[model samples]
Target chain A: MTNAERKRPGRPPGPSDTRDRILAVARELFARNGIDKTSIRAIAAQADVDPALVHHYFGTKTQLFAAAIHIPIDPMDVIGPLKKVPVEDIGRTLPSLLLPLWDSEAGKGFIATLRSLLAGNDPSLVRSFLQEVIAKEVGSRVDDPPGSGRLRVQFVASQLVGVVMARYILELEPFKSLPVEQIVDTIAPNLQRYLTGELPGLS
Target chain B: MTNAERKRPGRPPGPSDTRDRILAVARELFARNGIDKTSIRAIAAQADVDPALVHHYFGTKTQLFAAAIHIPIDPMDVIGPLKKVPVEDIGRTLPSLLLPLWDSEAGKGFIATLRSLLAGNDPSLVRSFLQEVIAKEVGSRVDDPPGSGRLRVQFVASQLVGVVMARYILELEPFKSLPVEQIVDTIAPNLQRYLTGELPGLS
Candidate 1:
């Protein structure tokens, strides 16, 4: 055995090692079979760890998924900052806050998570994350008509999801080549409309 | 062997059987490993056919991909009908014409194609489809600033892709539950704006 292997012989490979192994296995299984179909026991078996260890480390499957995907920031981090701005200004603020992340080094993980969601692995998790976390948080802060807040949040999610998929994931051009400022300038007003604008057909 | 198996045993299992088997294997591999990584030889090997047979049947990898995914309608069918309408009407006409395809029986193939694209299999195919096929065809029909038509088509593509992801794939609520007519009504004007309206920030 190598000196490094001999030194760590009886230590049970450390807590972080076990945690990392479980996460790696979970990510592979989730990517292959999707979030709904992969189970904790299966992940444990693949990782060669006890099932209880998986739960002990990650708490729930959803929590484990979040860990495996490495979602960089809380949705509220994006939504919370915008709450201080006037509702009218949020159109501009929304893209300003969110778009920078897509360009940053940290955004790669976010992109992977988004890609996995697009791949139809645990779509319910994405839906819940958007509705329960992002929409609920932002909706509580925004002053809109009763029950309209969720719809507004959904619209915002759709626009943002589309932009990321086009510009970052699919790399669809002119979008792929355009300066970020130009994209921000163009999309902000539309996002503003979705956030606060009236629906044309609905009362 | 059963009568059905006996009848098909000789003569290379007939044309349709060989073609269907090749396509099925290609779809599975493409979905699993993505387009760039999957090879014709590998697909043939998995399908239990000679490599030459795959080439003889499908002509090229691109053609095989097109056959496997089965994009339901020529994009021109969507673009062609809109051409008869005034250029100004194309925006509103677009969603009216194309969104219904998502909910149709044939749309299953489209959804699969989109999922594969989102999964990062042969993104170039989608890019070329959008640029060479959809944009080229649509741009020829629309009157816009010399270089801006491509950008407009891209914007429309982003919106349509996002809506389908949210409503069909991600199942974001409100969008998921709302009637399709309402979706068309709400989004048609925005698509129209992308199609013909003055972009907010561009000079």
Candidate 2:
């Protein structure tokens, strides 16, 4: 039957409906408390499902976070490889890993979610991911002058985010059509500088 | 009288109403037809006002476009300076001029308009401004390999746009709070590289 027919009153909530409810609750809690402070049990409780079921469906907290944000892949798929890369090489390695993913079909959902998140009142989810996840994972490694790593990653983030905007959103000609490697190679040095260079006020 | 009373139907349309109608028409035409193709007369005609009145209300087509986009300052205020700067200096010159303006009180409206524009279905107005206005102004100067100038400017746009996203929208700490000079100093070399650097595939 059609989705509308299925949604008529007295019908039991389908698995997809339950999953959507779980996702909605997960998004709310994750956005409010952030990835670090938010717990799987809390999301499960709010969704009225067992914690084990949440894990069974979405695997891990980070994975659930990814799904909540409509990112189809696990966060670790990229992060795991990143952990293996040396700090000095992260500049080049990052776009190399990410560009392909962002260029793929799944990337559309991510770009859409990002546009909506930025457009929405609460950018906390995006901020939380950048701060709690990306900063902690990559920023710690680039922390050459003790406490300057976060800012370094942030500068890198600005450029990377801009690339996303130009290529995907603004869809600037030639830029939108440029081969992925061209972009990666062009921005790599700049990203490297941000990660390891002697930036002003960073000492 | 209260704004509600002032907006009452019995009263004749105020100067503000006429100005707003022109701006709304300008925005619609600019978004659909782009800056180069759209004209003051067309916008004035659409708004049912005299073309001279449109010019009186807004100084020039570019100024009208700027107003349509909610940029409080005239577009020429920034573009006029860049016209004099040597190509080599543009990298440093741009952010030095822009960051302060973005940090100013008037920038709030521009940023809001930008957020809404990106969020909306038609990013055409932004695309038009970037392509027709910015690309024509700066891209022509940087066209070292003949046809590569536009792409170069687009890359620069990506980075600059990213800075706006990071500092203003994402509110990344330290990035958001960094002194304007610090940001300018940091991104200048990178911007210069994009402007004149030997980017891959650009030969």
Candidate 3:
């Protein structure tokens, strides 16, 4: 049978197409109901496919969410550049890699993803992304006193998230109006401190 | 007529009652649609009163928004304690005062109000409150090089907003679980730098 002759008009053309359709449906549901409340079965049901198909395409909910919000520049890709820098210089190198991406056109997707996270509907996803993805990746590279790496990563995340919220989302002026380079300069030292500085009051 | 006889069933009991009713309606509309989109006419109509009455009582839309989100403990009251501390100690004192309030029962109202602000429906209200109230009060006390005090105040606002978002709204771990005192200790120095330290980079 010829390719055109054998094709089903109503069905997605191929497996890749089917996967894309499932992802689109998943994105819509996740955005509306949040990641925690959105179930794979519900996504498959909404996508008009078998639940097994979702399981086949995306092995877990976290992977599915990562796919749904996937930008061209994967977060791993963003973090990859950090690996090249000396551990001590990671603080300075971190902002140079991150700030430009956020300022770029690609950052809009991230901004939206962040807004969804901050909407406080599904905190589990935010926690997972922070602890599992971000902390794991950044912490693995840095040598710290056992559990301190996670704390450092968390502080780093807090500062970065806060900057994004104020500068991009909230559009707080001075921050909003400042040149990107200036912002990088102003914030890099703070990020550095969070990454490696001593906790002044923690026992 | 006796006071009881003079009271009409449909009418508000007193001027203050009518004002309260209007404020309540304004709050609902602002929460639903945001401050910028919600009009005085809409608020008045929702409250079953005249637009002029809204204008008369609130004076302006900004004033009306300020009224709607007003917590029992004013921002001024929160800043009042900072006055007793030396300007150098303001950063430490500021969070010590604010975090306890947020951790208290009264902070619930502030949390709700903050959620409304973060919803991005009416940034003007957030900007006004930050600039006119917070910056003005804090700036008045801090002796900085000309124009830098506002910058300092804004930076302080950004940090506070970010901390509230992570700790309260997003509930990011460690930040969510950390004791208020630890958080104050951790963040106080950063606030101090923003408030008093030479800004590292600016044109």
* lDDT leader: 2
Give lDDT tens digits, candidate 2, residues A47-118.
Answer: 899999899889999999999998999989998999999888999999999999999998987898878966
Question: What is the C-alpha local distance difference test score of each model?
Answer: 0.76, 0.91, 0.74
> Which window of 10 residues has the lowest lDDT sum in candidate 3 chain A?
A117-126
Q: For model 1, what is the C-alpha lDDT against the true structure?
A: 0.76
Selected candidate, larger TM-score, 1 vs 2: 2
Tens-digit lDDT track for model 1 on A98-203?
Answer: 7888888878888887777667676765666676656766766553666777887777777788888789877877788887787777777777777778875445
Candidate 2 residues B1-203, lDDT tens each? 45686689889988988898898899999989999999898998999999999999898999999998889999889989998999999999999999999999998987897788668567888899999999999999999999988999999999999999999998988789889999999999999999999988889
The chain A TM-scores for the candidates, taken one by one, are: 0.69, 0.94, 0.70
Query: Least lDDT summed over 10 consecutive residues: which range in candidate 2 chain B?
Result: B113-122
Candidate 3 regions with alpha-carbon error over 4 angstroms: A1-17, A24-65, A70-72, A201-203, B1-17, B21-67
DockQ of each: 0.46, 0.79, 0.37
TM-score leader = 2
RMSD of each: 8.3, 3.0, 7.7
Give the C-alpha miss distance for residue B132 in model 3, angstroms: 1.2
lDDT of 1 at A18: 77
Better by lDDT, candidate 2 or 1: 2
Q: Rank the candidates by TM-score, best first.
A: 2, 3, 1
lDDT of 1 by residue, B1-203 (tens): 34477366454566877788898898888766666678999999999999999999887776676677686555556766876888878877888876788888878788887787777676765666676657777866653666788888888888888888888898877788887788777777777777777775444
